[model samples]
Target: MRSYHLSHSGAGLAGLTVRTHDAPVPGPGQALVAVRATSLSHRELLVLEGSYVLPVKPDVVPVSDGAGEVVALGPGVEGPAVGDRVMATLFGVEHLAQRGGSLDGMLTELAVVDADSLVPVPAHLSYEEAATLPCVAVTAWNALTGDAAGVRPGDTVVVQGSGGVSLFALGFAKALGARVIATTGGPGKAVRLRGLGADEVIDYRATPDWAAEVRRLTSGRGADRVVDVAGILHDSVRAVALAGTIACVGFVGRTAEPLDPRALFASGATVRAVAVGSRAQFTAMNEVIAEHGLRPVIDRVFPFEDAPGAYAYYAGGTSFGKVVIQGAGSPAGIG
Candidate 1:
C-alpha cells in the first residue's frame, strides 16, 4: 500500500514521506477500505505547525476526511459489506473525540478502520465530493442546526471567507430557506460566492468593517446566525442579532484582535466552538445532502502521487473550496 506519512522535517508539505509499504490487514471488527479520494483539513496543517491539540505522530497517515469503497472485512464485521461506498466519521461517538489525531487516518491507498466509524456516502454525490464531507460539511451543518436556536427559514446567516465550511454553510443555510451573506479577504471573489447562493458578498479588505455592512444588509437587525471561520469574534458579535448564535468553526484568518467580554454579553448571542460533530450529526448531515442533492465545491483534485502538491495547494490559502487528492484506485465514475 502506498501512503503519505508525516514526519518532523519542517519542510512544509514537501517534508511528507511517501512510501510503498505492505498493505495493512484489517483486524477484528474492522474493515479495509480502498480510499477513492481524501481532502485536506485545517487540523492536518495544525499538526504540521505543531499547534494541534495533539502533536503529529511520526509515520502516521495524516488526513481526517476521505471517501472510499469497502474491499475487505475482518473477523466479526457484519455490515458495510465489500463494495459499499463509505466515508469515515471523524468524530468518535463518545465525547466527540477526534478520530485522526491518534489513529492512522485516510491518506493511504487502503485504510483499515473500525466498521462502526464508517457511514454510507450520500448516493447523489461523487467520491470526490464525499471526500469533502467528514469534516467541513458536517461542521457547517452543525453550525446551522446546532442545539442552539440555529438559523431557520427566513433568517439571515453570515458566513466568513470562501473556505469549505463557509461555502457549505452558504449552501445549507440557503437550503434551509435562510439568506446567506458571505465575506472574503480576496477581491473579486464575491461573484463566485454569489453564484453559489450567497445573497450578499463583502470583501473584508475592501470594507474593513464588513460586520457593519452585514448589519446594514440585514436592515439593521443583524444576521440571525454567524459562521465565524475567520476568528473575527469581535466583529461577529457586532454582526449577529440579539440572541443569535455564532458558530466558531475555525481561526484561519488569525487577524482578529482580542474580543471584549462586554461586547459578547451585550449581544446575548450563543458563541459555540464547533468541534466538527457527532456520528449521528454526520449521518443527519448526509441525509440533508442527499435530499437537497447538494454537491460539495472542489477547488482541485490532485492525484495520489501528488499528495504533497495537494497539501501545498491547501496551504496556499487561494482555494475557494475543498482541496482533494484522488486515490490511486479511484474511478472516474465514483457515484
Candidate 2:
C-alpha cells in the first residue's frame, strides 16, 4: 500500500512524503477498501500548519475524506458487500455525536475501516464526486438543516464565500426551497454562484459592509439564516434577521471581530459553531444528493503522485470548488 505522510507539522506541503507499507487487512466488524479517490479540505491545511484545535500525530497519513470499493469484509461485517462503492466517514458515530472526533487520516491506497463508518455511494455519482461528500457536504448539510439552524422553505439564506461548504450550502438551501444570497471576494464568481442558485451575489471586496447589502436585498428584514463560512461572527450577527440563526463553520479570515453582547441581545440571533456531522447526517445528505442529482462542484482533480501539488494549489486560494485527488485504484479515464 502507498500513502503520503506528514513527517512534521508546520512545515506545509514540503513536509509530506510518499511511503510504502504492507496493505492493511480488515479486522472483525471492519472492511477492507481499495481507495479510489480523495479530496482536500481546508481543515487539512490547518493540520499541516499545526493550528488545528485537535491534536494530530506527526508522520500520520493525512486526509479524512475518501471514496473506494469494498473488496473484503471481516468476520461479522454484514454491511457493505464485495464490489460495493463506499465513502469513508471521517468520524465514528459516537465520537461525532459526542465530541466531534475525526479519524487521523485516509490518504492510502488501501484502508481497513469499520464497516459501520462506511456509507454506500449513490450509483449516480462518480468516485471523484463521492470522495468530496464525506466532509464538507455533511458539514454544510448539518449547518443548514441541523437543530441549531433549520431552514424552512421560502426562507432567505446568506452564504459567505464560494468555497466548497458555501457552494454546497447554496445548492442545499435552494433545493430546500430557500432563496440564497452568496458573498464572494472574486467578481468572476458571480455568474457561477447565480448558476448554482444564488438569488443575489455580493462581492465583499466591492461592498465591504456586505451585511448591509444583505439587509437591503431582503427589504430590511435580513436573512433568516447566515452560513458564516468566513468566520466573521460579528458580521454574521449584523447580517442575520431578528431571531435568525448563524452557522459558524469556518475561519478563513485572519482575525474575527469580537462579538458585542448588546448587539447580539438586540438582534436576538443564535450562533452555532458547526463541526462536520455524524454518520446519520452523512446518510441523510447523500439521500438528498441522490434525489436531486446534485453533483459537487469540483475545481480540479490531481493524480495521486501530485498530492503535494494539490496542497500547493489549495494554498494558492484561487479554486472555486473542491479539489480532488485520484488514487491508484480510481477508474481509468475518470480524471
Candidate 3:
C-alpha cells in the first residue's frame, strides 16, 4: 500500500512524501479500511510541523479526515461489515475525554480503526463528501450546540472566515433556524457564504472592525453567538455579540492581541474554546447532517499522490473550503 508520511526536518507541506508500505492485516477488535478519499485542514500542517498535541514521529502518516470501506475485520470485531463505507475518528480509541495531542492516528491509505471509533457515512453523501466531515464538522457542531445551549430560531449568529470550520458552523447554525452573519477576507467568499444560508456577509478586510459593523447590523444588540475562527479577534467577537456565546475554534490570525476582560462582564457573554470533538459528538453531528441533507463545502480536490501539493495549496490560502486528496484507484465505497 502507498502512504503519505512526514519528513523529519520540518512541518511544512514539503515534509510530506508518498511512499509504499506493506498492507498489514487487522489486529483484534480492529477493521481494515480501504481509503477512498481524504481532506486537508490547518491541523494537518500543525502535525507535520510538530505542533499538534499528539505530534507524529518522523515518517508518520499525515492526515486525519478520510473515508473508505471495511475490507477486513479482526477477531472480536462485529461493528462494521465488509463493503460498509466508514470514516475513521482521529482518536480511534478515545471515545470520551477530550483527545488532546495524544490522539494522533488517522491519516493513511488503509487505516486500522477500532470497532468503536468508526462511524457509517451518511447515506446521502458520497465518500468524498463524507471524508470532509469528521474533524471540522464535528468541531463546528460542538461549538454551536454541543452543550445543548439555546440557539432559538431567528436568533443571530456570527461566523468569522469561510474556512472549513466556520463554513460548517454557518451551515449547522442555519439548520437550527438561526440566522448567520459570516465574515470573509476574500471577495467571492462573502457571496458564497451568503449563498450557504448566511443572512449577511461582512468583508473584514473592508471593515477591519467588523464587530462594530455586526453591532450596527443587529441594532447594537450584537449577535447571539459568534464563531471566532480568528483567535486573535477575541475582542472583536466579544464586541458584536448581544449578551453571550463566543465560540473560539481557530487561530488563523497569528497575533496574540490583548483583550479587555471587562468586555465580557459588560456584555454578560460566555466564551467557549472548542477543539475537534469526540467520536460521540461526531456521531451526533452525522445524524444532523443526514437529517438535513447537508453537503460539505469542498474547495478543491487533488490526486492522492499529490497530497503534498494539496498541503501547499492549503497553506497558500487559495482555497475557500475543504481541500481534498482522492485515494488513487480506490472505488467510491471501497476506500
What lDDT does model 1 reach?
Answer: 0.86
Model 2 stretches with alpha carbons more than 4 Å out: 93-104, 332-335
Q: Which should have the higher lDDT, number 2 or number 3?
A: 2
**lDDT by residue for model 1 over 140-237, one digit each (tens)?**
99999976576679999999888888889999999999998999876568889989998889998889999899989988999999999888899999
Q: Quantify all predictions' global Cα lDDT against the true fold.
A: 0.86, 0.86, 0.78
Question: TM-score of the candidate numbered 3?
Answer: 0.92
Backbone-clash count (model 1): 0
Task: Name model 1 segments beyond 4 Å from true.
Answer: 8-11, 92-99
Q: How well is each residue in 1-335 modelled by candidate 3, as lDDT tens digits?
A: 88766664255666666778799798999888988889987777777666665544555666778888899999999779998989887665744321112332445677777767789999988888888987888889888886556677888988888789998999999999998888888788888887888898889889988888888899888888887878854565455564568878878787858767776677777778888787788998889898999999888888887777788889888788899888878665322
**Model 3 worst lDDT run, 10 consecutive residues:** 95-104
Clash pairs (backbone) in predicted model 3: 11-48, 11-49, 34-335, 35-335, 36-335, 53-101, 54-101
- For model 2 the local lDDT of residue 87 reads 92
Model 2 TM: 0.95
